[model samples]
Target: MAWVALIIAGLVETVYAAALERSATFTRLWPTLVFLAGVSVSMLGLAIAVRTIPIGTAYAVWVGIGAVGTAIYGIAVLDEPATAARLGCLLLIIAGVAGLKLLH
Candidate 1:
């Protein structure tokens, strides 16, 4: 289930990014710990996934998921901009990710 691992990794990457921001430059102890833990798990998942998937495809998918997921998280929870253009861009990324999965 490398694809499952890869997807989990990608989602965890979003958590890592959010936790990093909450860490406040690493000054916040709890968020910093969460960031560190998230990174460990995320990297482990990615490593497991790459053992089977092509590196190029896996990396591209990973990055695409993280980017889109993070943007959505920011918009929904962080009260970031929810403009139509930004949502459209996220849709594009999702389409690309799906395309990669389908092609592979």
Candidate 2:
């Protein structure tokens, strides 16, 4: 359940990040509010995950998952950089995440 929550928080963080980018003015109260809320949830989940999971392991996994997920979302939804180099980076992040989980 903690892992599930963490993953969900990561995805929500990705969505909010994308929304924030699209919000041109950066002054839009509603979008900014949502983004803050998402960040809060994500951080809370990270805190929970680190309680049971090792700090280094959980933090690495969290950052890895967040980076890969956000990059994918940026590519698919925002049409931002679909280059091979970026894809390779995403693969590396996933590989690292897998290694952490498997070796931990």
Candidate 3:
């Protein structure tokens, strides 16, 4: 389904985001390759989903998912700050994404 593809694309966005960080501006060979692969897969999924889903709604959801997931991963695994404000903001993003889905 288009929704499934969109979700997978969003998740891949997170992986690519993390990979981008690890890539060190493409200085590292493996991380750079991973980043490239992630980007390809993520974009392909997004393109597929947009064939069925509205671009505005689909893009917003994809970005929301990626942003939230990447932020959570950064806080939990990358030693980034896990402040109350950050958590609250992340929850707000989640709520927004849910609202978009419900309205759709």
Candidate 4:
């Protein structure tokens, strides 16, 4: 359950990051609201998960998932860079996430 919460938090963080990237003007009220809501939820979920998971491991996994997921979403939907080098970095992020999970 903690793992599930942690993963969801990470994914939500990714979504929030993407939303924030397009929210420079602050005129898009809905996306901005969604982003704020997502951030609040993600932090709450991480706080709950931290009760059981090691702080270092949980933080690493959270950041790894957010970075990789946001990058992938950017490339696929926003047509951001999906070059081989970028993909390699994504793979490395996955490896780090997996390493942290294996500690469980």
Candidate 5:
């Protein structure tokens, strides 16, 4: 259950991250609201998850998920560069997250 919350929180991190960009530094009303809501929910979920998971491991996993998800979103939706090196780095982050889960 805690792990589930952690994963959800990580996913929400991506939402807020992308929305922050769309918010134009919070100049846009709707996207700013979305970013604020996402930040609250994501932090709540992270707090719940940290009750069970180790802080360091949980934080790393959460960040790893957010980073990869945001990068993918940038490439797919924001017309960001999708170079081989970037893709490889993303894969490495995925691998590290997987390794953490497996080791846990």
Candidate 6:
């Protein structure tokens, strides 16, 4: 389904972000490869999902998912700060993403 594709794409976006950071400006080998693959799959999924989902809604959801997911990745694995404010903002984004889905 389009929704499934979209969710996969969104999750892939998180992988893409993490791999990119690990790529070290593309100087690395495996991480750069992973980044490339993640981006390709993510884009394909987004393109497929757009066929059935409204572009505006789909885009917002995709970005929201990516943002929240990547932030969590950064906090959990990358030793980034997990301040209360940052966590709160992530929850807000999650709420907005859920609202968009529920309204759809």
Clashing pairs in 4: none
Model 5 residue 101 distance off true place after TM-score fit, in angstroms: 1.0
Assess candidate 5 and give its lDDT.
0.94
Cα displacement (Å) at residue 30, model 6: 0.9
The TM-score of candidate 2 is 0.86
Task: Count backbone overlaps in model 3.
Answer: 0
**What do the candidate models score in CA lDDT, each in turn?**
0.92, 0.79, 0.95, 0.90, 0.94, 0.94
Model 5 — which ten-residue stretch has the worst lDDT? 52-61
Candidate 3 minimal-lDDT segment of 10 residues: 95-104
The C-alpha RMSD in Å for every predicted model, in order, reads: 0.7, 1.6, 0.6, 1.0, 0.6, 0.7
lDDT of 6 by residue, 27-73 (tens): 99999999999999999999999999898889888989999999999
Writing each residue's lDDT as its tens digit, candidate 4 over 1-104 gives 98999999999999899888777766788779888998999998899889999989988988988998899899988999789999998999899899889977
Question: Model 2 over residues 8-55: C-alpha lDDT tens digits?
Answer: 766777767866776556787888887778788889888887777787
Clashing pairs in 5: none
C-alpha positional error of residue 92 in candidate 5 after TM-score superposition, expressed in Å: 0.5
